[model samples]
Target chain A: MTTPRRRSQQDLSVHKRQVENLQRRLLLKEMLSLGALGMLAGCDLQDGDAVDKVLWTMSRWNDRVQAKLFSRTRLAPTYEASRITRPFPFNAFYPEYDAPDIDGAAFRLQLSGKIDDKRAWTLADLRALPQSGQITRHICIEGWSAIGEWRGVAFRTFLERIGADMTARYVGFKCADKYYSSLDMETAMHPQTLLALDFGADPLPAEYGFPLKLRVPTKLGFKNPKHIAEIFVTNDYPGGYWEDQGYNWFSGV
Target chain B: MPVHPLPIRVFHWLNAFAMTCMATSGWAIYNASPLFGFTFPAWATLGGWLGGAVAWHFAAMWLLAGNGLFYLAYGLASGHFRRRFLPLSPSGIMTDLLAALKFRLPHEAGTYNAVQRLLYILVLLLGVLAVASGLAIWKPVQLWWLSAAFGDFATARYVHFLAMAGIVGFVAVHLILVVLVPRSLLPMLTGRHSSSHEVSS
Candidate 1:
C-alpha cells in the first residue's frame, strides 16, 4: 500500500509538471510567433501545423479551467411550457428517419463497472423509480437552441438505485445508434441531469431517443447520449465519438 | 502631418486581423445552425467545419480581447481619447455631417472631423459590446450575471449578432472612405507621411 501510494504521488507530480510545461511552451510559442511576425513580413505563423496543436492545448486548458469553475449548485435556466420550442428540432449524426428502431419491450439497460448491481434494467424497472421533469433549453454547440420538457428519473437517484460508485471519475454511456459519450462524475451527479424516458408529456418517440436518453442540460446537445444501452462507471477516460475528433470532452455551455 | 502613433498602428492592424478572423469564423459557426432565415455558404467562411470554426473563433477572441484591452489602456494613459475622440459639439457634428453629405468636407491631415470622430467612437463601443455579449453567450453558466443582464442566453446571442453587424457596417464605410482618400492608408501603414501630403488643419 505504501509503495502504491508513493508511486501515485510521483505520477501526480509528473502530470502536474507536464501541464505546466505545456502551458509554458504554449505561451513561449505565442510570443515567438508574434516576434517573428515583425521580422518575417507577411509570413503567417498561424497557418502552421504546430499552431493547431497549440490551439488544441489551449482548448484543453480552457476545458480544465471551465471544469474547475463549474458549480453543481448552479442550475440551467428552466422555462415555462409556453416557452418550449414546438417541433424541437431533431439533431443527430444520422437523419431523423434513420433513428434507431429499438423494441421497447425487449430493451434492457445494461449496467457494469464499479457497480454492486450488474443486472439489466427493463423499462418497467426505470418507470417504477421516482420521476422528475424540467422544461429547459437544449443549447447545441452549432449555435441553435430549443427548449423542451424532459421527464425522467434523476440520474443520481438512478445511479444510487443501481449501486453505482459515485466516487468514480466518469460515467460512460453506450447507445443503440453506435453513439457513445461519457460525463465527468460531478456533472453526472448534478441535480438536473436525468435519464430521460419521456419528452413533454408523452413517452419518448423513436426519433427522440425512445428507450432512454441522458439529458444533460448544462452540457451541449451532443453530450446527452441518446437511446442509451450500456452504462459503466470507471476512472478510465472514455472518449466519445466527437470528443475523439477534437471536440472538447468537457463541452459545457 | 502627424502620423498615427506606433502603438495605435500596431493595435489597429492587429484588431483588423482579429476581427476578420472572428467574423469569418463566426459566420461559419452560425452556418451550422443558421439564424435570420438563411445560412452563409461554407465556401464563404474561414473554417470549413463547425469544429474548426469554433477553434478559430476562440483563438481570435483572445487576440481581440487582449489587443483591445491594450488599446484601451494606451488610449486612456496617453489622453488619446480626450485629444482625438471627445469634446464634440452637436453643432460641429451636424456641420460635418452636412459637409460630408454635400461632398465639400476638407480632408485635414492631423485631425479627425466630428462625424469621423463620432463614428469611430461608436464603432469602439460596439466592439466592446460584441466582446461582452460574446462572453455572456460563451459561458452563460459561469458568467451568469452577464447573461442575466441581457435577459437570457437568446437575448445575449442576438445582441452579439447585432454588434457584429454594426462593426461590419462601420468597416464597410471605413473602407469606402479609405478608398476615397487612399493617402490616409500610408500613415497607418508606415507610421509616417510625406510633408507634401499634409494639408493645413
Candidate 2:
C-alpha cells in the first residue's frame, strides 16, 4: 500500500510540472507573436523592395476588407427640424487645403478593390445619391466637445451602387489632403454616422473635411476622415495614419 | 544599512514641490472641463488659459516622475525600504498608532512616528497610482500598456482625477500637521530638527 501511494504521489508531481511547462510555453509564444507584429510595423523604416511589397500587400488586403464590412451596416441617421442643433462647432484646423494638388475637376475619387465594377466617381456622381442629415455631438479625444448638423449620402447605398463584394469587410478612406483613416464595418454603417458633405446646412468648410468627410458620432473626432479621395473596400484591417502613430484605432467615445 | 535606502533629501523636497504644482495645475484644468456637476468657476481658466494649465501640469509631471525614478533606484540599492515603515511588530504599530492619534507619542516610535509612517506609505502608493493614471489619460496611444491597467481612456481619466483628489486631501492634512508640529517641518526642511531631538531628550 505504501509503495502504491508513493508511486501515485510522484505521478501527480510530474503532471503538475507538465502543466506548468505548457503554460510557460504558451506565454512565450504569445510574446514572440507580438514581437513579430511590432517588427512588421517597424519594417517600414527600411527602404527598397521587401518593404514596398509588404506595404502594397497590406494596403490591398485592407481595401478588400473595408467594402464587405460597410455594406452590412446602415448610414448615419437624419435629424428632424426640432432636433437641429444651433452653433455647430467646427474644430478642424483652419485653412485645411494646404496641399496645392486639390483641383475640383482633376480631383477624382477612385473606388476599387473587392467590387464588380471598379470606377472613378466624379464629385457630381456622389451628389446624385440620396442625402442624409444628422445633428450629433463631436467628441474630441483632447477632452473637448461640440455639436454639429451634418449632411451626407448613406454610405451603404453608395456601396450597393458600386456592387461591393460580400468578402469585403471594411470601408477604408484615403483623403486628398494626405490624411489617411479607416473604420470597421460596424462603425462605418452606424445609423448616427455619415460621410458628410455639408456641415449645418452649409457646404463642408475646408478646415472640416471640405468636398467630403466622414462623421462617426460615437467615436472621437480624430476618427472622422476629412477630404476623402479614395474609398476602398477590404477584408482585412487597414491601418489609419493615427493608428500607425499609436492612437486608438477604435477611437470609440 | 538597507537594500533600499531612504530617498535623497533633495529628491524628497523636489517630489513634494512637484506634487504641489500638479495638484494646483490639475485643479485649474478640472475647473474648465468638469466631469461632475460641481463647478469651481473662480478657479476656472477662461478660453486658451486652460492650455497653459495643462502645460504646467505636464511639466511638473515630468519632474515628479524623474525624481521618483531616481528615488526608487536609490531605495532598491541602499536597503532603506522594508515591508512596512517604523519597522515594528503589528501589535506595537497598533499601540503606537493609537498613542499618536491621541497626541501621545510612544517611547519606542522610530524615525517615522506611527502616524507619519502610515501617511508616508499611503502617499507613496498614491503617487504611483497618480502617475500611471495620468499616462493612461494623457497619451493613451503612446502609453497603451499603461492604459491597459486602468481599463480605457475615460476610465483611466476618472481614476487619475480621483487619485489627484486623494493627494490634495493628504496635502491639506499634511499642512495642518506641519503647522501643529513645527518640529516635524523643520526636520524636513533642514534635515536636522533641533526641536525633535529636544522632545525625545
**In candidate 1, residue B127 scores what lDDT?**
97
* Top model number, DockQ: 1
lDDT per residue (tens digit) for residues A85-147 in model 2: 455555543353463245666667788677777788876777888898877656565565555
Q: All models, DockQ values?
A: 0.12, 0.03
Model 2: lDDT of residue A210:
72
Model 1 per-residue lDDT tens digits across residues B1-201: 356899998999899878877887798888887768987765557655677677767777888999999999999999988888888989999999998888878886557889989998999999999999998888787677889998888888889989999999999998777656655665676666523333222
Model 2 over residues B93-149: C-alpha lDDT tens digits? 687777766777732212666566677778888889999898776644335467667
Q: Tell me the whole-model lDDT of each prediction, alpha carbons only.
A: 0.83, 0.63
Q: Candidate 1: misplaced stretches above 4 Å?
A: A1-48, B196-201
